[model samples]
Target chain A: AQSVTQLDSQVPVFEEAPVELRCNYSSSVSVYLFWYVQYPNQGLQLLLKYLSGSTLVKGINGFEAEFNKSQTSFHLRKPSVHISDTAEYFCAVSSLGGYQKVTFGTGTKLQVIP
Target chain B: EAGVTQFPSHSVIEKGQTVTLRCDPISGHDNLYWYRRVMGKEIKFLLHFVKESKQDESGMPNNRFLAERTGGTYSTLKVQPAELEDSGVYFCASSQPGRREAFFGQGTRLTVV
Candidate 1:
């Protein structure tokens, strides 16, 4: 079974402040990792994914994440946040094969305080 | 190109009522998935369809829930006699074969009172 754990349920940060949302996962086999963001009343939008190659991945809206293998973590970060960045973030995992099922975390609500 | 689309963005019904949600995936995408997020819970996978065939349904809660992808184009998920526990946001996603990323729809918010 593949499962994703988003450590924080809510995060508050001032505008232009740096922030990080932690995520961890456990899987018996090789897996793919992804981060998605959802604005109020909207569906999930892909931010970034870690399928192969570099451990550091860059995504839209000045967001990025690092995949730490030993720690089993995929933490999302942003150097400076904007009020528009306030949204719910989710970490997801899937097996490393074609048509694999994707599992998602509980989600972290990022509240950007202007 | 258009993204995935789902209908009845919000629905409210009493317990034991029936509801059917619809989804239209992006054109040419062969993979469609169903997921749900209950109150204060993570989004959980419900099923996957590949070109009108069910690929995986291990996450389906029970027989009360049924999903179908007719003609490999649009899909529908029906919940019969829904319980209070079934209230949540239902999301539909789609991706082309061999793609790692899946695009999501706006989702159907079902409120079972």
Candidate 2:
């Protein structure tokens, strides 16, 4: 069984400040990590994914995340956030063993204060 | 280029009533999935379909729910005698075979009154 834990339930930051959403996972086999964002009353949109290759993965809207194998963490970061970036973010993981069952975190709501 | 689409953005039904939700996936996406999120709960997977074939349905709650994907295009989920616990946001996602990322629909919010 695989599970994900998002440390913070809500995060408040200035409009131009950097933000980080921490995520950790527990899995018996190798896993693929992903970050998704959802606006109010909207479905989730994929931000970035760490399948393989480079640990640092860049995504749309100037967001990025680093996959740390030693720490079992995949934290999303953005150098500067805008009001448009305020949304609920979710961290998810899927095992490489063809389980195909993606496990998601509870979700962290990012509140951008102008 | 259209994303997944679902019918009846919101529904209010009494207990013991039957409801059927529809989903139209993106063109040519063979893999379809069903997931739901109850109040204050994380989203949970219900089932998966690969071109009308059941890939995995281990997450289905019970026999009260039935899902079908005919013609390998659109899908439907039927709930018979829905209980109050069945109230939640139902999401439909679709993706191409072997693709990792799945596109989601706006979702159907079911309220069991």
DockQ of each: 0.86, 0.72
Model 2 CAPRI quality? medium
Candidate 1: regions farther than 4 A off:
none
Q: Tens-digit lDDT track for model 1 on A30-49?
A: 88999999999898999999
Whose lDDT is greatest here?
A: 1
Cα lDDT tens digits for candidate 1, B1-110: 99999999999999999999999999999999999999899999999999999999988999999999999999999999899999999999999998879999999999
Query: TM-scores of all models?
Result: 0.98, 0.98
Q: Worst lDDT window (10 residues) for model 2 chain B?
A: B36-45
Candidate 2, residues B1-113: lDDT per residue as tens digits? 78999998999999999999999999999999999989877788899999998899998899999999998999999999899999999999998888888888989999998
Q: Which is the leading candidate under DockQ? A: 1
Cα lDDT tens digits, model 2, A19-75, are 999999999999999998989989889999999999999999999999999999999
Report, for every candidate in turn, its global Cα lDDT versus the true structure: 0.95, 0.93
